[model samples]
Target chain A: MVSSFLSGLLGVWVIGVSTIDAFEFEDEVERLRYSGLIAEFRCPKCLNTNLSGSDAPVARDLRRTVYRLVDEGMTDDQVRRYLQARYGDFVLYDPPVRANTWILWFGPPFLLLAGILVLRRIGSRMTRVSLSDDERARLEVIRKQ
Target chain B: MKRAVFFAPFIGFIALVAILYAGFHLNDPSHLPSALVGQRFPGFELPELTSGKVLGHQTLLGEIRLVNVWATWCPTCLHEHTTLMDIRRATGLSIVGINYRDDGEKARRWLSLYGDPYDFTIVDANGDLGVELGVYGAPETFIVDADGIIRFRHVGDVNDGNWNREFLPILDSLTDG
Candidate 1:
């Protein structure tokens, strides 16, 4: 029974290894397009995971879609636009600077400006405080005493 | 000056908290926004489930219809079956089914057992159209207007609460128009 179980485990491992890398491309350009798209497109169902990396059903469906479109002679922009139209902007990792997402694009720069302003104000305040010569001499006298 | 600078972070924190608080109110987490809204339904040729007759965009053109993407494998579709039946009966609204990524025999059997609620069912065995529609999972429904434009999408099981809240209002307004 133990021997049979070990063989079963080995069989499962072999199948798993074979299945994950099963996708084939018709040509090099299609393969390149497929790989590039998979990295860029987000899986709608698995929010954080991209289409190529995710094993989620929706991701797999999207991958198949990308392959079909690429095979059908669609350009990279067309493929991206088609997906964006179907899945909305959420499916693209780098979403466009639209009304809804302008904050996302601008927020970091805005925060940086705010940070610089604060730092400059603090720096100025720090520079304003200096030891007078009299105070320095008094400190020297105290140290000597 | 130092105090004001220190207070800036606290003010920013409070502003963030307020924005987040407002965002929570604005967001309805249940609804997955449909990309097809305001756009015409994706054209497709599908074999009708019962008759195996080919139906395409022309079949869905005239009526304000509900296209439900469902399969036997999806548990929520089973739960939503009765609600679908009632919607058909009550409103007499045409509910078209897209049997997403499912076996034809299994889908037919499941529908017969559950009681067929759909006016017509489209067999999407390979889920080609489902991918085009960006269907994430089963039991996703779209409300298509008379002009073939997709008006709204409901992403999960259509229970009484959602029906009353979500589907009814749209139905009323569309009918009113």
Candidate 2:
């Protein structure tokens, strides 16, 4: 009963914290855009972490930059381009499809297809090797013995 | 078909291993390419290091120059100071400094003690301009052409080896052009 009551209290606290500290936005659409972009921008200082998830000093500064630019009525693409101009293409979690990245995009599916083909071949070969009638009779006699 | 399929996975695995080995051997993770390269330097208005006079990006234009991002707190800056002085004396190339995230008094004192090598140091106390320049660490040197396009950026201390081997060749090419 105590544990259940404590869990209920924790749930209420989490909800209150999340709801109360959501930065006030003049436009609801703008706030949504801010959250979306933060999740998309890579933290320059952290490996494989988005700006919204990082607590690095550079990440904090980048978040402020996003907020300032968004507040100034810059579109999402413009804000992205601004960061790209400084931090390079690496700052985008989803880099643009290009000649250099073609392998990264197509490699997994190709590998999967190859794997399936290999598995199918092996499965067929295993089925094709079903024991001959004499071999099967010998196995049955062995089991009886 | 069965034989080919059996061999395919091994061939593919070998190929993948070779590719992974080449990538790990060739690529340096610490050296990230700067988007600002081949682009114009970002504009900023910063106070000159001891002087109260304000300077902007325009002040750096009209000459082939080196803009070095440095700070009093960074020990690497001390190591690169003599090298910067040598470059200034040897090439007579304009070397501008960006004093990043430092107290004005401390920066001035640091320079005073070290024998200032910069043509003019811009005080970037808040590092706002450093952010604009995409500087993550101190002692990053940028080579800007007369047109103000950034040609090269050196991220670490500019010792004799880099100065002679890396920087000089590029400086010669830019100047020749």
Using DockQ as the measure, which candidate wins? 2
Per-residue accuracy of model 2 over A36-120 as CA lDDT, tens digit each = 7887888777767887777665676677777778989999999999888888778887888888777778766777788888899
In model 1, the fraction of reference contacts reproduced equals: 0.48
* Error of model 1, residue B135, in angstroms: 0.5
Q: Which 10-residue window of candidate 1 chain B scores lowest in summed lDDT? A: B27-36
Which lDDT values do the candidates have, in the order given?
0.84, 0.82
Candidate of highest lDDT: 1
Candidate 1 lDDT over B40-109, as tens digits, reads 8989999999899999988998899999999999999999999899889988889999999888999989
Best by TM-score: 1
Candidates, DockQ: 0.38, 0.47
Q: What is the TM-score of chain B alone in each candidate?
A: 0.90, 0.91
In candidate 1, which residue ranges exceed 4 Å CA deviation? A1-26, A131-145, B17-31
lDDT of 1 by residue, A34-118 (tens): 7778878878887787787788777777888888888899999999999989988888889889898776687657666777888
lDDT of 2 by residue, B1-177 (tens): 667878887788788778878988785655567878898998888889878799988998899999999987889999899999888888889999999888899988988898888889998877677668777677899999999999998888899998889888989999898
